[model samples]
Target: MNWFMEFLATGFYSGKLPKMPGTWGSIFAAVLAYFLWPSNPDFQVLVILITFFLSVVSSDYLARKLGDKDPDQVVIDEVLGVEITFFLLNPQGDLELTLAGLILFRIIDIMKPFPIRLFERLPGGWGITVDDAVAGVLANILLRVIGGFL
Candidate 1:
């Protein structure tokens, strides 16, 4: 159906998805990260980085197609960013790391520290996606630091 394709194309109705598309997308992304990232730190880190990059480039186009400014349903950016955040912890599919990464990503995402806010101001999809990438980076750093101590 036309609606179904549109939904998938816009990231499962996230573009017009209710509430905060970015936040919802990130939640979905976090869940995905839990399943996709390998137990091996190196592999997980690589995947995270790659995914982040791809999301950054793609989210804009997705947003445009959906006919909205950073539609809530086009949540791939958030999902990718959250995945990057959790990948920093290299959780081996553990719930604790997933939870921690989720909290950290959400906090930093909401706060939009410094350049993160700047990134959001960028034009088009890049603007839409970069902010979340920055949040992911910050969260990743914090998570890595905590990981070192644990």
Candidate 2:
């Protein structure tokens, strides 16, 4: 149903929140991941893959419904991005790491540098999702590097 798709695409209605819905959705994802995601790397990958798929499907549907290339209400992309940000690193549900990943992911997503921005030019769901996905990966890599140094 449309309501169900909308709920998913809107990141469980966090996107409907006034101001910076993407940030809200990212936070939601981070919090949810913190509580629900397990410590297994394989499980993390599986979760990410499943989230990515749902993001694409829901985003595409939302775009079509809203008649926008990337509606602000579709924050599932942000959710997926944040999930990818933590990836294998936040499986322990460490609040500090989760917070760091959330901040880094939001910054990278907002900045949209280099190839990250380029992904937005893709059609439909991919156009809406890949850019954030790249941002998430970049943030995760940055976290890994920072962890390595510390």
Candidate 3:
């Protein structure tokens, strides 16, 4: 159980990287989304929502063991963020669009502008998951708007 939590918290070990674990986790999420993305919008929404809920549980439990509000190595939040960002845009297998979404989501997550930062303090895994979820929502809107122009 402990190792399983660590595995999940580490975003399948992408978070174990020496630097920028969140970024690595996001990258992993992007690759996963590219390969396994669903064609149906309903399914995409379902998958991301489930991932978010599971991440919240595992992340909160692991955060408790680590004695940190949000440990750097706990990056399932990154996975949730990336999944949410890609859910509505239909980026799927499009390399350029997926890359753009990844970049945008990471920037917003890293910067945590406006309410993004506020969501980080929501308590337990809710805090850990939502900040990045907000970033994902922002990235999704931007990606949709920009993808329309290009």
Candidate 4:
């Protein structure tokens, strides 16, 4: 059970990579989103919501196990964030849009603007997960706004 939790918390070992584990996890998720994301928006939302729930649980468990506040190696949050980004901006799996979303999400996540950073103050899995989700939502909105101008 710990092994399985660790596997999930680490984003299938992407988090164990040399550096920027969150970026790697998001990249992995983007690839999966490009290749396998469903077409229906309802299903897309469903998937995102399910991933969100799992990410909270997995990240919470891993954080407690590691005795860290938002451990660098726990990147299920990144996976969920990237999935949310794709769901909003590239639900049809457009490679270009998905790439754009990936970049935007990474940037917003790193920058941690305003309330995004605030979400991290929450307890347990909520802290680990909600910040990235907020970043994803912001990235999605930012991308859409940018696309409107282009």
TM-score of 3: 0.96
Model 4: weakest 10-residue lDDT segment is: 84-93
Candidate 4 positional error at 93, Å = 4.9
TM-score of 2: 0.96
Q: Is candidate 1 or candidate 2 better by TM-score?
A: 2
TM-score of 1: 0.76
- For model 3, residues 38-77, the per-residue Cα lDDT tens digits are 8799999898888888889989998999899999999999
Task: Please list the C-alpha lDDT of all candidates, in the order they appear.
Answer: 0.71, 0.89, 0.89, 0.89
Query: In candidate 4, residue 102 scores what lDDT?
Result: 89
Ordered from best to worst TM-score, the candidate numbers read 3, 2, 4, 1
Listed in order, each prediction's TM-score against the native is 0.76, 0.96, 0.96, 0.95
Off by over 4 Å in 2: none
Error of 4 at 6 (Å): 1.0
Model 4: residues with Cα > 4 Å off, grouped in runs: 91-93
* 3 or 4, greater by lDDT: 3
Higher-ranked by lDDT: 1 or 4: 4
- Between candidates 3 and 4, the one scoring higher on TM-score is 3
> On residues 1-150, what C-alpha lDDT tens digit does candidate 2 reach at each position?
989989999999999999999998998898898898777889888988988888899999999988999999899999989888888775456888888888899999999989899999999999898999999999999989987887
Per-residue lDDT tens digits for candidate 1, residues 1-150, read 555444443456554557776667666666666676676778876776676565555665666666766666666677767767865365547778887888898899888889799887788877877787788889989988887799
